[model samples]
Target: MHNLYIPVIAILAAFAIIFGGQAISDSRVDDEIKSLISKQLGVDGEIELQAMKEVQKGYGVCGQYQVADQGQRFVPFYYSKVNERVTLDADAERYRRHCGS
Candidate 1:
């Protein structure tokens, strides 16, 4: 019975370690993504960060922000580290126009 318990505990421990590692990895990825997005968007001051669900793609962070002009109307943007690119959707053409390639 003790040996059976030991194996079960080992399996549980392994799973916990795997899950913890994954969580850490995910947090790091999120932080990096946030930093890149903020830089690209020229978000210097304190920002109300939000992850937009509608524009989200695999391994990318997508979101919108309301500028002084828009007054709570969020304009969409995309950030992807894999591609090292940030893109604003058509609705955000004003922002995109200012951001030269």
Candidate 2:
């Protein structure tokens, strides 16, 4: 029926908006993570972002980075959206001590 179709369309539209918003949020956070890492390591290129997940304040990002032929290194970082800061480590001692990991 026409009324049934309306509800279906509304549900689909809601889903689209929710998913689209989340994707845009993730992309922005990922870009921020890359910039923070670049600044911290003093390198602009060779950053390979592998994974990212939402955390309490911001996100937990993991990636591989190569610095001036030093070979690729696996790194994890925590970016705090609330404080607008980044730290090295997301689930380790150092991060726990500093940012509750």
Candidate 3:
């Protein structure tokens, strides 16, 4: 009976760890990420996600927000990881300067 209880407790602990980690990472409104988005985009609010063909489409990592500059919008946009190393190319150098990364 004592041995059976040990296995039951171990299983419960494993489940708790798995689900707890998943819940934390899946949260949609992380303060740190939001602050970064706000700082980079120079705008803040709900991210626009118009489904109509003629409407503006918001894009971001994890599909959460728009990151384009006010006057520099473009289709097929791109975003680099905040921690990614800056490449030596002119475009990448410009990006690093623009984002202060």
Give the total clashing residue pairs for model 3: 0
Best-fitting candidate, scored by lDDT: 2
TM-score of each: 0.57, 0.71, 0.40
Query: For model 2, what is the error of residue 27's alpha carbon versus the real structure, in angstroms, after optimal superposition?
Result: 1.0
lDDT (Cα, tens digit) per residue for candidate 3, span 1-101 = 88999999999999999999966853432444445555555576533321111111322223223443443332121233345222223245443443333
Best by TM-score: 2
Candidate 2 regions exceeding 4 Å error are: 57-70, 89-94, 98-101
Tens digit of lDDT per residue, candidate 1, span 1-101? Answer: 77799889999999999999988976675566556656766765433445553223355556654444335566566555467565656455533443322
Candidate 3 yields a Cα-based lDDT of: 0.41
Q: How many pairs in model 2 have backbone atoms within 3 A of each other, for residues 3 or more apart or on separate chains, i.e. clashes?
A: 0
lDDT of the structure predicted as candidate 1: 0.58
In model 1, where do residues sit more than 4 Å from their true spots? 46-74, 90-101
What is the descending lDDT order? 2, 1, 3
Candidate 3: worst-modelled 10 consecutive residues by lDDT: 50-59
Candidate 1 vs candidate 2, TM-score winner: 2
Each model's lDDT: 0.58, 0.65, 0.41
